[model samples]
Target: MRRMKVEQAAQVIDRPVYKAALIDFLYQLADDELFLGHRDSEWLGLAPDIEEDVAFSSIAQDEVGHATLFYHLLSELGEGKADDLAYSRPAAVRRNARLVERANGDWAYTIVRHLVYDIFEDVRLEALASSSYAPLAHGAVKIRREERYHLLHMETWFTRLGQAGGEAKARVERAVAAVWDDLGDLFSLGVHEAHIVAEGILPVARDELVQRWEARMKPLFEAAQLAWPGAPHPAKEDGRLGQHSADLDALLETMGEVYRIDPHARW
Candidate 1:
């Protein structure tokens, strides 16, 4: 299929089914970045070292920027202003994977989580870079460029933590176990999987993308001498389906607190 620019896609999306599917796909992309970026921002002045704090701050900013880009695309589709879509939505309406919604635990947990999330994001964005939806494809290209740095940074930390042995290795191992169960939702497309794929918004199938994500991560896990955590179980509440954990509720409450206070007031 020929790539359709945002305007062209919007015209075709006059079909209700296509419009709903496109919106669902975009929300999944945008919410994941927004939630994870917010989680990363929690580390602002609290990262392990001064240098790492600076690096992580930059990464958080990038993730939020990526989220903003996706949200703007959603706004063009008439979902409302980007900030409103991001900050005003309730947890039940969010589309981010459960993995990102979990609270950041220790530095070990944070590092492992970042590594896992970035791997999945890397694959997802690669697929989007060729999306039949032109705006998403263009945005993916730019986001993926920045994501490369995130991947490198996380991988380095993952390896360092894994090889640190003793307490560090043990901590990372525990984090892996804690996070492994929720990973399945990263590939989930909810009930709209068929429509999203059928609409050709995402050129790759969800299963194929998941496979590619695992393939890329296996070697890295081995190199780090960490046992692959095996397959992830289905999420208890699928985030793609708008079913989320209480963690998300608390997160949204905090994230939107100031915005909700006076949404109309300029920041």
Candidate 2:
């Protein structure tokens, strides 16, 4: 029985090819959310303002929840339990782009990542809402529902900080420029683009997704009075592609310390 009601509908591709694509796509989704969430969690009591702190905490939790959903999907594919897959992956094997692995840098940078990543994610999920694969299609629909809150939160801060002027404006501007270069790969298909599309899992092409993201972000940039910085850098066909940063390695070690000790032991 179909678990989700098919909505609008998308073109069907190939299945076997899509399975691997699905895995790759989900890995990017889960790993990015997990790493970003971990970094954000460190700021729990460190935020500058009480209200802002609470808001950041909520954003962190949402990222973790997003990761959990993707990990569960991976588990259904025989990868392992969601927790195991999430906490046990080797750093070098992680597929999250370098952008997410970098530290929050500053309140400005953190917000920058939140806005850029969240907006791009919104576009991607909206596109995926029509995924041909039943599971992904359904999951995308559910995720999109919660994502509205994220966008709203980020947009509020983005406008406040961007227009606040002086220190705040300078900080946000610097933050936006800092990560603009590395932000490109966040939309990359790596080597799975054709596979995913060929399998009819996702409706649109990866480039198409990038274009849509750029279009969606253009108005926000204008509203903030931020200038377009041209196209972001593409992944260098390693690490994110198959190559990863040292940060990921250390993250794995820390996250896995307890789990690896007694895989069968209940927490």
Candidate 3:
């Protein structure tokens, strides 16, 4: 694909019922992908193996693409330019959960994050694929088509690292345990959530969505001998509700540096 494709931006929904909620939903979607893409971009030249490096780069590119799509939607709503919204927001103002911004750590942690985040993203995207808002549903469909490869690549690593003896297994297990506490934050809907649900843009209940995610991921974790995380940590008191870790601060500095230099300059 080209560096970026201006696939038609989502059509404007003029009805008040859908308007604010959809915009908020779009921002959440855009923010999550933008931060995750930034995290992935950091790994461009740092992956363990060359073939793995190449495969990961493709996934990173897709994340960037997904961010661009939602950015365009936000731009159309007059919420500043897409790049500014992505790269100029204050760290606390960023809507992404801390999980997406956490450093990939060692190769094992990177793979662990990859497996966890990608699986969750796949579940969310599948839900979005059926969005009540036609444009979003369409965009989700297109994006999910590319997401299959991303999920597969990560799944393969999860299996390899899980079944591998000694060091690799220990690494993955530790990383998984570390991230389990923050997983629910990924599914959080913020203050604008009532409007989002009432507006029918994302029709599924949050718990149901999480359950679906669990169902989808359970088998993969079982096969790898990795335990699925127990208990749900609500985002209300969690780092996802604009309450983030220091890791987010570091990420925003790097992610926003280029855009903040001259927000008007065409890159």
Candidate 4:
């Protein structure tokens, strides 16, 4: 049976398991955006070319803005202020995939990983657009508009690197191999995944999400004439479970440095 829409946060108040599942899913969504946005910002003034530097900076801003939107949704559910939620969480409670926490390697790695993750986000957002939770579905519809441009930007780079061949092709392929390990966790929805799906918060299961992402990548692969890397293998540590790399710790320290000094200070 199709689940009825949850029109508001107050509708979820009496359902503990369902509400918890919803909260966990929101954390994953918010954290991934925050981490990846931070990574993109690191390329500010350091991108391979001036135009690319500006473009990446803009994308970073978009991603962080998206994170703020998700955190705001959490705040509506009584999760606390959006600023504190993004900057104050310990690594153990974060639900983002470890892939986002990784350091941006060379340009090729950044291109490959960002494109790969964007493809996954495309799949995830499509699912969310129809989420039984009405607010989330509406929000996803808004996010997808901006994300389409992001996907286009990354796909352009991914194909450019692949078709360039010679040194460029070699580097992109190597980055693909390196990034595959982290890709495994990209579809995971944490410990509450079953409940989340059961509650119709995401509607799509993990395996289906991965399948859709892989299918979507085919055209890009063909355009670049790149070989399939097969399915991504899971990382040994599960970021969905709050397990994360030291890289995330360093990221939090830096990202929250100012906020920590004065949690109550207006931004």
Best by TM-score: 4
Q: After superposition, how far is residue 113 of candidate 3 from its true place, in Å?
A: 1.9
Which parts of model 2 have CA positions greater than 4 angstroms off? 1-15, 237-239
In model 1, pairs of residues that clash are none
1 against 4, candidate with superior TM-score: 4
> How far is 58's C-alpha from truth in model 1 (Å)?
1.1
State TM-scores per candidate. 0.96, 0.88, 0.90, 0.98
Model 2 agreement with the true structure over 115-176: per-residue lDDT tens digits:
88888888888877766667777888888888899888878878788777889888888888
RMSD of each: 1.6, 4.1, 5.2, 1.0
lDDT of 3 by residue, 1-267 (tens): 111111333444445545666776787788778777777778777888787677777777789889999888777777877777877777676677667878878777877777777777778778777676666778888988888888888888888889885999898888887777667678887766775665556767678777887787789878888777775577544444577788888888877777777889976
State each model's CA lDDT, in order: 0.87, 0.76, 0.75, 0.92
lDDT of 1 by residue, 91-182 (tens): 88889999899999999999888899999888888887777677888899999999998999889989888887999999999999988878
Model 4 scores a TM of 0.98
User: What TM-score does candidate 1 reach?
Assistant: 0.96
How good is model 2 by TM-score? 0.88
**Ranking of candidates on TM-score, top first:** 4, 1, 3, 2
